[model samples]
Target: MKSTSTLLAPEEEFPTALSELPVLEIHVLHSRVCRQLDHEYLTDPAGAHPVTLDRHHELVAELDDRDAA
Candidate 1:
């Protein structure tokens, strides 16, 4: 698998909390969490909460809009 570092350019600004870690480490963490979320959803699609996902999507959209500005 290509490292997460390959997905993002070097000049990209990471979240402040992750600034101290190597970009590869941050990517690994993101990949692991996404995999875990996917597994959880697969095991119990209805059991998983929707509100948090909705909020996440909203936030992402807002961020995208900001970036596009």
Candidate 2:
């Protein structure tokens, strides 16, 4: 598949591609990692941006729930 990143202008994006191994499952695996981190590690971790962390956790939860259904 052509990379969607190429649709962006050169200056607006960096080079990236879906790696060969398990490209189809990357989203599921990545979400599991984020959910683990959100629940187990990132709560008020020192020197981090609290607002950004909160937003990330919210997104992770939403995705996880959608996938679980």
Candidate 3:
């Protein structure tokens, strides 16, 4: 097997907030959370934890707010 990393290059500064990230990065994060929620639903449909859902909502709201501005 081989190993890979997603770490940024040393000269690349990581964004401190979602608002600071590029559009593609934001989409990737949203996609990741959606996938997580899907898995959580599969394992426990009735009582999935609220944290993931909250994050999803937050991302959506941020995008909406950005679009509105």
lDDT winner among the candidates? 3
Model 1 residue runs over 4 Å out of place are 1-16, 46-69
Which ranges of candidate 2 are over 4 A from the true structure?
1-46
Q: Assess candidate 1 and give its lDDT.
A: 0.46
Candidate 3, TM-score vs. the true structure?
Answer: 0.66
Better model by TM-score, 1 or 2?
1
lDDT of 3: 0.62
| Clashing pairs in model 1, backbone N/Cα/C closer than 3 A | none
> Which is better, 2 or 3, measured by lDDT?
3
Clashing pairs in 2: none
Question: Local error of candidate 2 at 62, Å?
Answer: 0.3
Could you arrange the candidates by TM-score from highest to lowest? Answer: 3, 1, 2
- Tens digit per residue, CA lDDT, model 3, 1-69: 111323222233323477877777777666666776777678885844577777678778778878899
lDDT digits (tens) for residues 33-63 of candidate 2: 3554454445545633444355345545555
Candidate No. with top TM-score: 3
Cα TM-score per model: 0.41, 0.33, 0.66
